[model samples]
Target chain A: MNEKKSSAGLKLCISDLSMSFGGVQALEGVSFEVEPGTIHAIIGPNGAGKTTLINCISGQFIPEGTMHFGERELTHVRAHNRIQMGIARTFQHVNVYSELSVLDNIMIGGHHRLKSNWIRQCLYWGPYGCSREEQMLQAEALELLERLEMRHLADSPAGELSYGQQKRLEVGRALLAHPKLLLLDEPMAGMAKQEKKQLSDWILDINREMNITIVMIEHDMTVVQTLSDQVVVLDFGRKIAEGPPQEVVKDKRVRKAYLGED
Target chain B: MEPNLTDKDAGTAAARPLLETRLERYGAVGLILALAVGSMLISSYHLSLLTTITIFAFSAMGLNLLSGNAGLISIAHAAFMGLGAFTAAWFAIDLGIPILIAIILAGIVSAGVGLLFGIPSLRLSGLYLILATFAAQIILYWFFEQALWLTKSPDGRFVGIPEVMGFEFGDPWHYYLLVLVFTIAGAVVYLNILRSGLGRSLEVIKERPIVSQMMGVNLQRTKLIAFTIGHFYAGVAGALYGWHLQFVATEAFDLMGSIELLVMIIIGGLGSLAGAVLGATFIVVVPELLDMAGRRLVDDMGLMAPIRMFIYGLLVVIFLIYEPHGLARTWRKLVRYFNKKLFKNKNEH
Candidate 1:
């Protein structure tokens, strides 16, 4: 497959990665490379194991083969520690702190960045006088909210937001982690066209402005075609096609997988 | 000079009064006023009862953090309290340490023990974690009963009168004041922790462990901290219980005591400071009130205990089935209803 390029800028590598649940093989010998500072899209029909692939990369699923981010091995890293190693992710379904304010939801995303000890937090003071670290976190979280045009909803409970807003908030939350590699699973699913356009714009802006590598699973062909630098198409837990979106979409096998024809 | 306020600023300004109700602003003042009035009106016997309620409230608040906020159910809460009581007694009597230091040391020791028991929770949750805590309750109660070095007395360990500086807190009145102060301090600390990052992390972890992990919250560490902090509060309550009664016994902190503390949090509201206090008062005073009524209705006072237990069991069942959120939620609903009615009438006028 074009010599499987492995230059210095390769941000993520998955080799011979296989996962199974009971007797069902969700993924089998999947291999891919995501370069730094680019948007890579994985598209597939139902049960193509797109979500499972992201889960394996995010450490929720234990796959058979090795996976690495940069040079660091991520195969055995705990899910929480993966975030510390600059890996962050959003779910297909909206998962947020429903009871907490929108601001607090994003501040929790910046948890690893804040260095104040638990004892200091208990005392309502930190190394930088009293509550300075907390204030800094608040400022950072507010900046993210402003960027997302959600500063007006800061004090509102996260659950009270509209579904599209919740989806945007989820992205803002993951961004607050300052991840080098962000995995987004169906981020634009269930959104109207206008909402999808706005979200696509935000995603592109995030990739360009922050120089963060993004690996996303999307069912929207238009989104994949417009945004992806590279596209990997999966069918039945196997890579059916891999290339730039324009070339991959025109492939006979990808069409067969999507249309169920020989 | 006049300020230029934007639409967003005006929106937030309009929302402020709607968000911050009278109860939200003056709730603390109301609590203090109630406590002061209660102290003045009650007899010395009733004063002791008030102190007992305050002590239970402290432990209930602690348990609320674990079971309510962190979503880790524990049935060994009183065992931690027993450990604290024994530790305080040993330090105060054997080491001749001051009572205040002894209490703090007791809390520390109980927190350590709590951390040990909390290890199982790293891998277990819900009913499985509750079972682990049940094991802790049984084992710790057995240890307190068998260990003569710690218990010291076959009947029970008798703690000396607690003293700070030159003031002896032997009198019920003085001791009531001491308990009140500690109870208020405990409530303040509980509220502070709820707003802190650590507390928020626990809530996230409890709500969605996988999501919390993605957000960079260490699930195991946060769970362990919640368990330890809960036990620390329990220890302080136990030490206070020992000082109030001048006694500590294995029988006092048995399985029943643990269940009672759990019941207190459940009935009051799970995850709320006010709920803890309300539940404590209900659990402590309800039986006494029932006994008083039984005295007038029937000549047999012996039947009162069983009747109270039956009623208590019924109340718990009713709450669990009908109002799982507990009394705090019910209170909030009532306040909201009244506020709506009052505001509706005003708007019409």
Candidate 2:
């Protein structure tokens, strides 16, 4: 495969990262590079360990090997700290603050970058003044909300949104973290065909407009075909195929893995 | 992503009442104002009871932050308060520290002890944490009773009255005002913290600690803060209670006292600050009211009146099962129901 040209000023390099729970190895000797400003897809059937790989990269597991975003080592980083390094992810299933307003859900993602101290916040008056910091954070959060076409539901509780809307809101939240690298786990899962189309368009828009390097795990072949700049297939926690979507889709092993035949 | 928000929805809509209510944080402020004004008008004895209720209410509010918001139940808050009371007494007696300064020091020292006990919470939870607090109550109660070098052994009455700023705090009225100021201020800070980012983080931890950790909220740090703050508030309340009565013993701050505070929160409402006040008032005043009713019944109808404690216990259980949302939710529903029935909107008509 050709070494793809980098564009979004980020190249995530993972080498020999492995993890095990008890005696069962979740991932072993997994190595891959997601080129900058491109959609790198990881596809697999049920229990193929796609989510585990995402978990490892997202700091949920302390892996045995190095995972680097640009030049910084991510193998030992905490999940939230990774956001500051421009790494963000959405769960395969929607994980969001249900009781909070849609706007506040985004604000939570923005909280990582907030500079306000507890002292200033507690007193309601301080040397730095919490009101000023709070207003600015709110402004930024509302801006991200509008971009995701969720401004109308800003005040609505996040749980009130439909599945598709919640998915969009999750994406909006990840964006609010100001990530240069976004890992979307099954962004198109459980969405209607039209909803999938809308989400796909937005994902592409984000990549094009904001130039975010997106590493997505998609089960839907149609989504992978339409959106990914490159594809990497995993099965039973092993890399099955890696290349452009057209090349990877035509591979015998890739077809057999998806179709369940040799 | 940088999303441009300035170009959209700048002034397109009227603010919803609910959203405005969140922004205004009217609940805490409104409750304090109403209670303060109401307290001033009551008879002096009731005013004293009101002061007790306020102190207990603030203590409950602190616990609510830890137990209700942060999902760490505590049964040892009263012990923390006891520590504060004795610390203040010891300081006032041995060091001759001013009452206000002593109270502050008591809160700080109690918070230090609270921090130590809270360390176990990093590894313990639920009934285990409750058990840990029970152990704390027993240990502290023993120390208060037996530690002669520090507390002068039983009958902890060596502590003198507190006077500060040239104003004697020995008077019931003076102490009541002092309690009122501190309780109101404590309630205000608690309300703000509940509405702030820390509140969200606590709720997040309560619902999903792993998710909260992944979201970048430090679980141990957040919980430590909750435990310390809760203990600090309880300590302040105890210190104030000690000085007001000018007499305190192990009996004043014991395991049953901790249980009573828990019952107050549970009966009033678990998560609502307003419920803390309602619960504290109910716990403090209802017994006296029942006693008066019992005496009247015996005098007029030739019946017994001393079964009030049994009735109070029954009320707690019934409320727990029947209206688990507590009196605050019930009160809200009643208000809303009357508002709808009494004042139908002209638009609806």
Best by lDDT: 1
User: Model 2 in CAPRI terms: which quality?
Assistant: acceptable
Clashes of 2: 0
Give me the runs in candidate 2 sitting further than 4 Å from their true place.
A1-8, A126-128, B1-41, B293-323, B331-349
> What clash pairs does model 2 have?
none
Query: Candidate 1 clashing pairs?
Result: none
Residue-level lDDT for A136 in candidate 2: 60
> Model 1 off-target regions past 4 Å?
A1-10, A126-130, B1-26, B33-41, B331-349
**Fraction of native Cα contacts reproduced by each candidate:** 0.43, 0.21
Q: Write the per-residue lDDT of candidate 1 for residues A178-244, one digit (tens) a residue.
A: 7878899999999999989988988887777676788999989999998889999988888888989
* Highest-DockQ candidate: 1
lDDT of model 2 at position B197: 66
lDDT of 1 at A200: 91
- lDDT of predicted model 1: 0.83
Q: Write the per-residue lDDT of candidate 1 for residues B190-233, one digit (tens) a residue.
A: 77677667778878988888889868898889999998889999
